[model samples]
Target: MGFRAMVCHRFSKLVLLSAAFISLVVNAAPWPDGAKIAVTLTFDLDAETIWWNDADTMTGNPGSLSYGTYGPKVAVPKILALLEKHDVRATFFIPSWVAEQYPDAVRSIAAAGHEIGAHGVRHVSPLQLTPEQEAATFSESVRVLDRIAGKRPVGYRAPSWAVSNATLKLAARAGFLYSSNMMDADDPYIHNDPPGLVELPVSWVLDDAPYFWFDEDSWNKTIHSAASVKAIWQEEFEAAYHGSGYLNLTMHPQIIGRPARLLMLDEFIGWMKRHEGVWLTTGSAVAVYVRGQQGRSP
Candidate 1:
């Protein structure tokens, strides 16, 4: 080959390599403040509302319903203490009924400087409600949360992760800054349809219900050991740490606050802290950061 032709080919290769590097720099480092990974430990504090709203309920039996009461009665304080020990601020999405029924629990969560987002009115899915009912429930959630927490919640995660087509638009109309129901992406993105509402995606893999939720009435007897769940979550966290740099772990106070499971969660948080460049924050903070990054109002 002629020297000039060979030189031209080498120049083109160099340009392509430079472009690839620039793309990596822009796309790979999405987390803020040079953090390698962003983590939000979110809890859906459904409490007794789930028992009453879900069809799987054994609500006829007081013993069956006591399981839900265990959440706010015993689990929440323990969960709060655990989070306090780690000095990690997390998010709790509570149904309005839970907040009202256990105002003190909600107050304690807020006093600890955690974010409280809307779950629904009575843990009912938006899909189960008509548009008017959904709107009313959403508004009631905002009202109760604001009343109890002393701050209006800016985030929403639909009960049971059952979001309808109107849920996002309704949340947007109600002035929510973000929704955490969708599982489409690993990273947060602004919804084009709502035109500025941020979506912090979630998945069942990262949620505790599939692994730990046991409902006798529903005949769901599967409950893995805490060690197994910890290993699964650790693997998932590592992958997120290396890939998209975002990990949102969803849990319930009743399920994860059990002694062994809570111990596992404490150990997991410690393990995560051992890694450098990890930001453990709340859902609201994540939404604000991602929105600010994308040139939108937080």
Candidate 2:
């Protein structure tokens, strides 16, 4: 072959080989074949109304009254029934205040094979607390949840999605395996604080509470009906279903317990059942899976 033709041929062959190698590496990843995505359902069981503390009392903060009005009476039961009906497991991020009020509910959740996680002592924003206060909150929350569930909570999720570096450090120091407080990535990642904690990043866009509270009218307009929410969830699931990526779905029992919104959750669970090869699990399970993969890797 002529010199120019030979050079071009070699370059094309190299490009083709590189493409094949890239394809092989991606295809050989640990996720099961035809399984592109896994989802972990995490509920923030704030249970605000159950507390007698001034800051958490129903009369003190009517907007935060999840426990007294809806949680114990309607939401928790509905959520449990829905999960049981679908045969799916989930994680409940319980504040120390809530665990103290509803020890029976915490035990029931543990018995039902779901994961329990710490969600601070009160539903106060982490950014508002000093480092010492944050550490105490973490310690107390862990202690309370462990007492109720008979197992130490391995994961933490900040109340109101408000977190700080200090909060993360405290969580790590408290012996948590993971925190869902960081929104830096779409995938699960190991965060290296001085004490080291993995951050299974959760998407706020994927959560339902913000949608309902901040943009209630817009949310109603967008989701329109139950089918709309179901369609959006399915689309997101399909997009995430091709890699060993993590999907975190966040919900508040009170917010999603309404008859209309519950229907949407039911539909989404139905769709999840129709699909095969997806690992529907709790946040702790996802954290464990990621930790296992880290251990296996060089």
Candidate 3:
């Protein structure tokens, strides 16, 4: 063959080899066995603010109160009942104030064999606070959660999904083992931050808060209809079932506790139970499993 043709052939071979290697690297990561799907049901209990405070008498409707209409009184019992009925455990992310005010409720969750983690001290977003302020808030939250649960919280979900670099550092400094702040990926992976906390990326698409709080107009129009929401959930579940990826479903007691909303939740749970090989567990359990796998790998 001519020299020019030989050079072109070698370049083509190199390109093909590089592409094959890249593909292998992308698909080489092993997913967890047994359907490779872990369904984490996380509830954010944040009802301590003025709009949600039982003592607060705010007649006019506020943005925060828009979602706060569903409080502990309406949410806790239903959630407990659902968990018990389904024989499933969940992670309840409670604000420090809620833990203090509803000790009985918190105790009930712990007694039910579920995991309890810190949501925040008050329901304030982490982005709103300066680094120093955020650190102080995080420290107090950890102390309060530990006091309430009788153990240091191993996980955290930033209030409003509001996270920053400083917020992540604060979480690690506070000794959290995992944080569900980043939405970069669907799988649970470790972030090499200072405290080296694991990042269990919770999908905003899987959460009900954004629909209710952020898109009030659209949510109001579709709040009664569970078809769209359920379809997306089922699709994600099926994809994860096939791909062996993690499926995390997030909800709030106040939002999903209403009679109509509860029906939607029930339907979704029913659908989930019909499937085989799905691992329904708490966020902490999934994190622990992933960490264990990492430890065993060479």
TM-score for each of the candidates: 0.87, 0.81, 0.80
Q: Could you give me the TM-score of model 2 versus the true structure?
A: 0.81
Writing each residue's lDDT as its tens digit, candidate 3 over 169-241 gives 8888787888887776656765644424677787878887655444444544334356677777788888876
lDDT of 1 by residue, 141-234 (tens): 8998999999999999999989997999999999999999888777666676677788888999999999898867777578899999999999
Per-residue lDDT of model 2, residues 1-298, tens digit only:
1111000110111111132333111112244343456688888887663333465443555544533457646788888889999899999998888888888888888888999998888777788888988888988988888888999999989887788768777777778898887666666755544323667777766777645543332444333455666677677777766432557888877777778888889888888768777778888776775554442322
lDDT of candidate 1 vs native? 0.82
Worst 10 residues of 1 by lDDT: 1-10
Q: How badly does each model clash, as a count of residue pairs?
A: 0, 4, 0
Off by over 4 Å in 1: 1-29, 53-59, 218-220, 295-298
Best by TM-score: 1
Q: Could you arrange the candidates by TM-score from highest to lowest?
A: 1, 2, 3
Q: Which stretches of candidate 2 lie over 4 Å from their true place?
A: 1-29, 32-35, 49-68, 194-196, 214-224, 295-298
Clashing pairs in 1: none
Q: Candidate 3 — which residues are off by over 4 angstroms?
A: 1-33, 48-69, 214-224
Give me the candidate number with maximum lDDT.
Answer: 1
